[model samples]
Target: MTPKRVLVAYGTKHGATAGIAEQIGTSLREDGLDAVVLPADDVDDVRDYDAVVLGGALYAGHWSRKAKRCAERNADSLKHRPVYLFSSGPLDSSAEQQDVPPVPAVAQQMERLGAREHATFGGSVTAQTPGLMARVLVRSGKAGDFRNPERIQSWAHHISAELATLP
Candidate 1:
């Protein structure tokens, strides 16, 4: 059988979410799946694919608007196939609380578009580029890079296996 076609689309502000999406696409390809990574705003259609992975960056307890738009726009087509949603957020290292808020409305909407799984991953925060108030928050030790490559890799493996097994 031909490899399953998967669309891995994402939104990012600092580029971290984009990196995560690329990693997932790479893993899927390594598993012999036909995966394409594109910015959420750039993906025109989902009807041609067998599976779709929608991702976004979380800010102030909300998923990126662009990601939500992509999913919403393709909802009808996506619902006919397997769908997954992911978020890159949280500056907390401890998985116990992760200092992350619940999945935002935008992400929830994406899941409504036939998502089979939704995963939230820790992300990075930069002090040098922060605004005045954000810089103060960072200087006060309230910010840090909480991203764990191992955790990301594990999720990628799971998705890769699932996509590879699709007929």
Candidate 2:
């Protein structure tokens, strides 16, 4: 049988969310799925995939607009497939400590898309990140990479297992 095709798309500023998406794609691949990672802006269709993973970066308690627009644009197609959502932000260990709920907009998107689940992963703000605020935060020793590869891989593998049980 052909491996399941999964689309892992993300909306990011300063590239943190993109990294998370890549990690998901890698993990899914390890689980024997055909995963493709792309920027949310470039995700024009979801009909070609068996499952979809959509994620975004959070800013001021709001999910990224790019991610929202991707979901809105692909809503009809996404609803027919098993869909998952994620958020990458919270430059702290809070996500590791507890289940962080999706922001309101993301919750609405999840309901609209019939997404199966949502995960919140910690974000990063390294010196290499672009933008004045990011640099300032890094310089102030206030920001660091909090994304955990183990957690991300665990989520992806879980998705892969769930997909195996689906029709």
Per-prediction TM-score to the true structure, in the order listed: 0.86, 0.97
C-alpha lDDT (0 to 100) for residue 72 of candidate 1: 81
Candidate 1 residue-wise lDDT, 16-135, digit = tens: 788888888887887788999999999879888889988898887789888888988888888889888888877675532443443758546755775777878887776854567457
User: Candidate 1: minimum summed lDDT over ten consecutive residues — where?
Assistant: 93-102
lDDT for model 1 comes to 0.79
Candidate 2 Cα lDDT to native: 0.95
Model 1 has a clash total of 0
Candidate 2 ranges beyond 4 A from true positions:
none
User: Whose lDDT is greatest here?
Assistant: 2
lDDT of 2 by residue, 13-67 (tens): 8898999999999999999999999999999988999999999999989999999
lDDT score at residue 33, model 2, on the 0-100 scale: 97
Q: TM-score of predicted model 1?
A: 0.86
